[model samples]
Target: MRANVDFEDLHFERRPYDPQVAYAQAKTANSLFSVEATRRWQDHGIVTNTVNPGGVATGLQRNFTTAQKESLDAAEAAGVFTYKSIEQGAATTLVAAVAPEFAHTGGHYLDDGREAYPVPDDASLADHPHGVKRWALERAGALRLWEVSTALLTA
Candidate 1:
């Protein structure tokens, strides 16, 4: 059976590192993984895709302290920022999982129930060509790491 997953929804919001940075890296890894996995598993009838649900005020947001939380909440309430509830947050994943429209073997990012683009950082945009090449190299490195780790455990 085919499965559709969104990596952003699985983010660890409370990590010590910057949340945006972490999410960006995870999103990159996820896109690369989906592309590589589909290529490797297509013969077995497997398909994979990705989604990015902007910001949702689920339990994940509880990681913020009182002051930070208040600021986020105010921004969200003012309509200046878009923050979905937990149920709303799950909508993209649900659509991806069962929607025939997204059956194609590709990746997508969703925000507010529609197809959306990732908000690229200024640095990333400036290094677009270099970023793409680096991402390709990183994917190869990740595959090697996976191989070595698996081999060590299964040897």
Candidate 2:
């Protein structure tokens, strides 16, 4: 994706993954893309990073039935979790955009103005070396879906 950019007009934001499993994969992909792009364009000073705003009460929860939401709320109330308001939801994103600490932290995940932890040892990815390489492979698969259409139009 970085290989075909018009930097002067570059502006893009990815959607958040809803399902936890998909979200994890998306997060991983986001990390890899940022790392690979930064390495591929370090001279240009391009930066990329991931931001997780903990939990937010958003319309995305519409997919969850009332009972589910209630259960979630109950769980949160029990001190097992917490959710953020919309303003709080945007905090990490804001920090990512302007925080001095992030000026040099690339290919990392930030949450609530600080670096967040990654998922526990998942054997599927724990054994992999060169995170960016894995990301490139996954992104290559994603690119394949659009390659033909892009070629046809550009040609």
- Candidate 2, residues 36-149, lDDT tens digits: the string is 555556677777777777678877677766766787789788876678888998988999999987786576667677765443343232232212333333445334423533
lDDT for model 2, please: 0.56
**How much is the lDDT of residue 44 in candidate 2?**
76
The local distance difference test score of each candidate is 0.53, 0.56
Runs in model 1 lying further than 4 Å from the true structure: 1-16, 65-74, 117-155
lDDT of 1 at 73: 74
Clash count, one per candidate = 0, 0
Residue runs of model 2 more than 4 Å from their true location after superposition: 1-18, 65-71, 122-155
- TM agreement with the true structure for every prediction: 0.56, 0.59
